[model samples]
Target: MGPKLPPARFVLKSFMAESGLEPRLLPHLRVTNAVEGKVDFELDITKDHTNRLKILHGGTIASMVDLGGSLAVASKGLFSTGVSTDLNVTYLSGGGKIGDKIQATATCDKSRCQYKTSIDYRLTGNEVGMTLAYTSVVFKNSKGELAARGSHTKYVSKAWQAQSEAFTLPEDADIAAEE
Candidate 1:
């Protein structure tokens, strides 16, 4: 990398706050890394996330693909809001059991004021290399994984350079905590 950039955690947090997703996913979503055109996020599969087969639910995987890809778009500092235009996911393996770790990695292709992002995700169990899910989301910002991945897209708005003029956070804001 030529030079490191700000983490997407703040951007995601902002989105979460504005969209009121904190109560839903803040406990699980974590920005592992964010810089330039790359963003990484992860979630641990818990008892609350299991499905009928006692496996990680498909919905959880889709969440990953949405959030993961959005981070990539946010990191570019282009759009304040990244609206998912489309999404696509694929399930390679079952996310069996609880206490599993699911990681999503996102990369971007930047243009004038927009970014095209793709997120690749994998879920791992304690011992077994559980393919809990594998997915790729072509997101601009709106959402998250395989266990959801096919074709996802979004529309993003540019951010203000001035902190004072930057986006505002809501009362029950998730991004506020990160900012």
Candidate 2:
């Protein structure tokens, strides 16, 4: 089959399109593959994303970790990936210099983010249900060497949240793709 679920990158791309920092900084990011709970991508390092040493910057890596986690959550069919609860990044290498393509894959380590249940709860019950998502990312250099790794957590328990299914559909999905 083509894919088990619709690629969530479209939603992510749309978000990036509207984001302030992402629009200027992550201009070169490309979603190679995206499915439920997983997202693979690549980026060509440029001077804007480098350090004084002319290699990938640590801040840039950190930013990618945040984005990767959001993308992973999006893979599970969530548009608003929620707020970051935690984020960690370990730089194994410099990734690469300008013009070098850095490949990365982010996988949802744990996910129970249900769109319908994200805000669902018993009004009378004092106990609240738990819904969260965790994602891990591995970055590789052009030579296939380990460049960096990271982990991220997102809290998607949208209290008083309101959402409609039609708000997140891709153009193709709402058109003839369903037939």
Candidate 3:
């Protein structure tokens, strides 16, 4: 049987096509899978993403995983606004090169008031084989993988204050006010 589609899939799909988010977050962030509670994504490794070690930069992996989790929760529309309270990652392997596709899977786990999430990233190469580059990634690392293990907590917030959903910000909000 085919995978079940999430109610929010169309909204996210429209957001991607209309918002032009791919170029902003590296082409790899494009969503390849969007199920009821999960998302699958991929990124092609390139010189632009390499670090001094000539492998996939840890930061890139971190960002990908973080975005993956965010997208997962956003799919449900469970919270209006949210922030990563903590993020932990474990780098098991690394690879880099043009045309190298790295896949990542993200899921949301809201067991308590906070949203617990996790992401797993994998890189596959004909020469390097398949390697696990990241696991249990959050906004930052330190809490460690075992602690995360497909379950980490975050604080979800309201997206709107007293303004309407379609309300626009004040014209001078972007500019500094003179005394």
Candidate 4:
């Protein structure tokens, strides 16, 4: 074998530290696994994540879906920080309660290059080893039942490279030439 590859958890942890957003926006989320084009995330539903009904809030679930898909794309050893172009979620159940474990797995369905790279991702969730939701992917409650499913589309920037001035032209070149 060649040099041993780092475990997914370590790679994700390092990436999250560099990301500088997880600790703020998703303090409850944790990366359990990550590999090329795929990532798994888990969150323990707590009182803070619930709504008046004491079930997981829809907004929280949506955030998890978005993060899951984005991380899956990032796990490809590419730059993160892509902006979401579109995100859609469909709630199927209301089973996530406080103290329940929720898990999501995101998979990159397609990646394409344009002026900017675009990634399509699917997310799924499971709770207690049972399917919870499936859309682009799924979400599950602690008992392993579906909660929500979602899909996310993002435009990823290519690795930045410095451009020399000599090879560049100003945006107002046409007007300058006319003058």
What's each prediction's TM-score? 0.61, 0.80, 0.54, 0.64
* Runs of candidate 1 exceeding 4 Å displacement: 1-6, 109-151, 157-179
lDDT of the candidates, in the order given? 0.49, 0.70, 0.43, 0.55
For candidate 2, which ten residues in a row score worst on lDDT? 121-130
Worst lDDT run of 10 residues, candidate 1, spans 126-135
TM-score preference between candidates 2 and 4, better one: 2
TM-score, prediction 3? 0.54
Model 1 / residue 1 / CA error / Å: 12
- How much is 99 displaced in model 1, in angstroms? 0.7
Q: Residue 141 CA error for candidate 2 (Å)?
A: 0.7
Best candidate, lDDT-wise? 2
TM-score comparison, 1 vs 2, better candidate: 2
Winner on TM-score (3 vs 4): 4
> What lDDT tens digits, residue by residue, belong to model 1 across residues 28-92?
67676666556666666677666878777777666666666666655544435345666667676
**Model 3 stretches astray by more than 4 angstroms:** 1-25, 78-81, 112-152, 159-179
Candidate 2: regions farther than 4 A off: 1-6, 111-129, 159-161, 164-168, 172-179
The residue pairs that clash in candidate 2, if any, are none
**Ranking 1 against 3 by lDDT, winner:** 1
lDDT of 4: 0.55
Clashes of each: 26, 0, 1, 14
How many clashing pairs does model 1 include? Answer: 26
